[model samples]
Target: MADTAFHSARQRYADLGVDVDAALSRLAGISISLHCWQGDDVTGFESSSQSLGGGIAVTGSYPGKARNPAELREDLDKALSLIPGSHRLNLHASYGEFGGVKVDRDQIDVSHFAGWIDWARSRRMGLDFNPTFFSHPLAADGFTIAHSDDGIRGFWVRHGQICRKIGAAMGAALGSPTVTNVWIPDGYKDTPVDRLAPRRRLEDSLDRIFAEPLSPAHNLDAVEPKLFGLGSESYVVGSHEFYLGYAIRRGKLMCLDAGHYHPTETIADKLTSVLMSVDRVLLHVSRGVRWDSDHVVTLNEELLAISHELVRNDLLGRVHIGMDYFDASINRVAAWVIGARNVLKSLLIALLEPTERLRQVELNRDLTARLAILEECKSLPWGAVWDEYCRRQSTPVGQSWLDEVRAYEQLVLSKR
Candidate 1:
């Protein structure tokens, strides 16, 4: 019955000038990076008592959260087992395996992340990295790179530098370039009198961090900007405009996070413009309910639009897609699988669209036909195609994956 449904769906899509097989093939090639922080609510093993500062907050205390590298990896392995296709792992510098040794952010090196590299290697997964700029004593004031004090600014800069090297090492080990994204929680709660000074400091600090160049094959650098954070409601130092200009000028990958902007603003429309200026782009896919809450991603309108734009513009190869959300209210591994599968589902739907026909209609200035076709496309048998894709990948189709998650919770997470 599943195969019969897929065959009919394929014929329907083919009638509309879409190739279901080709779409599924392309979807399999796309790898979404899963964030490791989601397993532990961004609570890295650096210090058990470390407070989650710098405008970051995780609500709801869900049990079975991973307390160490072993548990985190175990949970991650379980989540990846349910998720279809090849995927990468995204790690924060704070999540490095220190083996009970105290390694400050500035002093962290490739040795700390050697365990992670081996883990990824064993699973044949690529790894992405981020610098730990928040949840530390130095960042208590809600500033790091843009700090008024030079010594504090230097500390974060050194941290970023070391993180890049560690990212390079992981890429080398996995034979895939690792994207090391730099995002700082540098802003103020209230309106600042001198915003220019802090931005200047941030620009200089970023320049220093990226000064030591590494091979592009080993590592790719990206800068992420946020509109506002919890405490930095009044002003966020690394605003979108700042990083857009910096990325274009410096030839760096500009990371456009979905939840970093206003609720009404979507990164979907910005894809074409950014790709024209920058060589590459990185996306941190997340859902923001009225703010940058980092809720688990769903197959919502914005996510679908993002997927459509990427497919339409042929930007998938030039873009690095990664999931960035932490919802501690539910089973952590379930959240990972849900967000990842939703992202892949969106991409599959986008790929299955009759883009060429739509383009032809637009070229003829037939807006009516274009709109009609788009609306009709939504009601197509994309779900059948997705189930087929999941079956081909040997992952659970439909809600069956949830059972596995629940079973894991009973056997593994419950013990925690």
Candidate 2:
């Protein structure tokens, strides 16, 4: 019955010059990097005494949070099972396996993440990494890499170097390039008189950190910028313009996090602008209610616009999609599954659009028909096609996955 519905819907889209099957196939091939912190409330197992700092905060004290790597991986596996299509794992430096030994952020190496590589290799999943710039004693002052204190700045610089090396090692071990993203919460809570000094320091530190030559096949470097953060509301050192200019000048990938910009500014519009200068781009797909709060992703207008822009520009191959949100308010696994599915669903929706025809209409200056066709597409049977996609992937369709999450919560999460 679902197949019949999908076939009928497919024909409807075909009449509109859209190939539903091709869209599904393209969507399945695109891999989204799932953040590991979502499974454990961003509390990596590095140290229990480590307080969350650096403009980072995880609200809600939901029970059954993963306490160790084993638990976190188990929870992630459950979440991945519910989400259809291939996916990757994104890990922070704090999430490295220490084997009961005290491994500080600066001292972490590839050895600490060897187990993670093995785990990813077993599942045939790629791994992305991030340098932990927040939540450390050194970063408590809301400065890193740009701190006035030379000692503090050097410590973070070393951490970034080590992370790049580790990222390369993971890529070599897994036979897939690892994207090592560098994001620092270096800003001031209040207005600063000497903002130039900090930015200059940051530029120098980044230069030193990325000086090492690494093959792109092994690891690619990306620098992420933020508008503002909890403690850095007054001013953010790594603003969008700073990183945009730096990325273009340095020939590195620029990360545009959805929650990192102003509420009114959507990254969908910046896609073409950035892609014009950079070879590759990274997207941190997230949702922010009113600020840079890392809320779980959903199929909203902004998300759909991002997807549409990517598809409209034919940039699926030029951009790397990664999920970046941590909401401990609900079932953590459910959060992952929900966010991942929504991202894929948004891309599927974009892929199913008749972009070629729409482009031709706009090119021919047929404004009336273009507007009419685009509005008509909103009422298409996209849901039926999405349900078929889930069926084809051997995963639950629609609300059925919610039941699986509840069962997992009761049987697996409840015990934790």
Candidate 3:
């Protein structure tokens, strides 16, 4: 049932005595990003991108399911029904139902959240959720959840509490290690002067969420940061990835999203290396064009094959590869299957690469060399390097990120 080409390399290696069994087992933890339930078809998004990346890092059923306040359970059943019997669910995007911004606590009366747990338990599936706030123009305010404006301030906390609660419940589920995903869309264009004041408040709020006594089962906290350009000034795009390490009062790990960096930035290796250097590197995965979070991954077979080779050689922990696409055209089920196959195939091809793939390490963000760096840290487990990571990750949110927004907002108010 796996892609024939994806398997060809493995079969060939089997003929050559390259330990195929070990490779497949090592590639277990695959996850995907779904934007379907959020009202975006997102079906063709992956199809289009996979054509380019050759299907590098993508796996699992990213149904693109969004939770609606009115019928969370209804949508849950519909999405669960859509996931083919074979695959697992990962990276669920919460695009508040009926076009309300964020998950409406008012509409979440019935425990649709419970159904996902039951669904995973029933089919032995895994689920990863990303909290998204749309419909609220203020979301552009981004992480400065500290904004004291009438309708803007505190969105982060309101939504944050929900994430923490979900994390607790998800940690209790079987086969679901990655329970939380945080991505801030508030990118600013101008610079602000007084940023530290707000940054501290945001960090403290985040601490409250992560410090909630962990359930252990819920292990990976997915931290995906993105960058935006074509702006009048600089915005806090990629800096927060490492800042998380220090701010997490409770232990937490960072997830390096492949598409979140700017075009020239190519941050996969940089973020991963930074996280690894400090030791908050819990998971490694990616999607999108090399430049932006277009979410569409290259569908080229050769590319997928090559990426697979990288994963095999890199020793990446939990390969949750799946398309981070959000558009409509293909069936959710088909898109998921296609994306999954591309990722699986890519891994197979990676095995075909010469064993010395490590020798070719370039200073890229995918952290090709850092895998070796991590390998050398055998003497120091996470308990060993957590403090160091925390120290490096402890960047306080500066007003600069906010300054970008403040300048724009002030201009808008002046015009009004």
Candidate 4:
């Protein structure tokens, strides 16, 4: 019955000039980087008593959270098994294996992440990296790179410099370029008296941090911007404009996080504009609830629009797709599967679009036909094509993946 349904759907799509098979083929080639912090709720193995500061917070005490790297890897393995296609793993600087030793952010080395490199290489997966600038004593006052004190700012600078080298090492070892992103939660609760000084300091800090350039094949540098956070409600130093100019001038990749912008603003609209200035982009796909709540990715209007923008504009190669969310309210592994599958599903729907036909209608200035075709395209058999994709990938078809997660929770996560 499944095969029959898929065949019928394929024919139906073909009638509309949509190639279902081609869409599945393209979707399989694209990889969405899965964030490691989500598995452990941003609580790295570095310290148990470390407080989440610098405008970062993870709510909910969901049981079965991965307490160690081993457990996190175990849970990731299960999540990856359920998710189709090859994907990359995104790791933070704090998640390195320090062997219970006191390794400060500045003191971290590639040696700490050797285990991760080996694990990713063994699985034939690529890796991405981020410098954790939050949740530390140095960052307690809600500043790091842009701190007024040079000593404190320099400390964070060293961390970023070291993280880039570690990212390069991972990429060199895995034969894939690692996008090492820098996102500092440097801001003030109230309106800053002098935002210019901090911005200048940040620019200098970043210049020093990225001075030792590595090959793009080994490490691609990216800077992520946030509008505001918990304590940084009034002013976020690294606003969108700050990084957009920096990226354009420095030739670095700009990371557009979905939840980083205002509720009314969507990253989809900014892709074409940002790409015009920056050479490449790194997307941190997430669903925002009024603010940067970091909710799980859903197949909503924004997600579909983002996916469509990438597909229609032919910017997939120039953009590094990744997911950024931490929903601890539910099963952690299930959250991973849900977000990843939705991301893939969105991409599949985008790829299955009759872009040429739509463009042709728009080129003829037929607004009526363009709107009509877009609405009709939404009702097509995209879900059937997605099920066929899962079947081909040897993954669970539809909600059956949830059953695997429930069973794993009983056998593994429950014990944890």
**lDDT for each residue of candidate 4 in 1-416, tens digit (9 for 90 to 100):** 99999999999989888888888889999999999989988989898776577787888888999988899999999999999999999999999999989999999999999999999999999999999999999999999999999899989999999999999999999999999999999999998899898899999999999999699989999999999988999999999999999999999999999999999999999999999988899999999997665998888999999999999999999999999999888899999999999999999999988999999999999999999999998998889999999999999999999999999999999997
Question: Residue-wise lDDT of candidate 1 within 37-67, one digit each (tens)?
Answer: 9999999999778769887899879999999
Q: What overall lDDT, based on C-alpha atoms, would model 2 receive against the true structure?
A: 0.92
Runs of candidate 3 exceeding 4 Å displacement: 1-17, 25-87, 91-110, 137-152, 194-198, 229-233, 237-250, 265-268, 278-292, 299-314, 318-323, 329-333, 356-416
The parts of candidate 2 lying over 4 Å away from their true place are: none
The whole-model lDDT of each prediction reads 0.94, 0.92, 0.43, 0.93
Candidate 4: the clashing residue pairs are none
TM-score of each: 0.99, 0.99, 0.61, 0.99
Q: lDDT score of model 1?
A: 0.94
lDDT of 3 by residue, 175-268 (tens): 5565465555443567866556555555655665465565647645655544553331265533454455542534455555555555444433
377, model 1: CA deviation in Å? 0.5
Number of backbone collisions per candidate? 0, 0, 45, 0
TM-score of 1: 0.99
- Quote model 3's TM-score: 0.61
lDDT of 2 at 349: 89
Candidate 2 lDDT, 21-88, residue by residue in tens? 88999988999999999988888888766668888889888889999998988988888888999899
The candidate that wins on lDDT is: 1
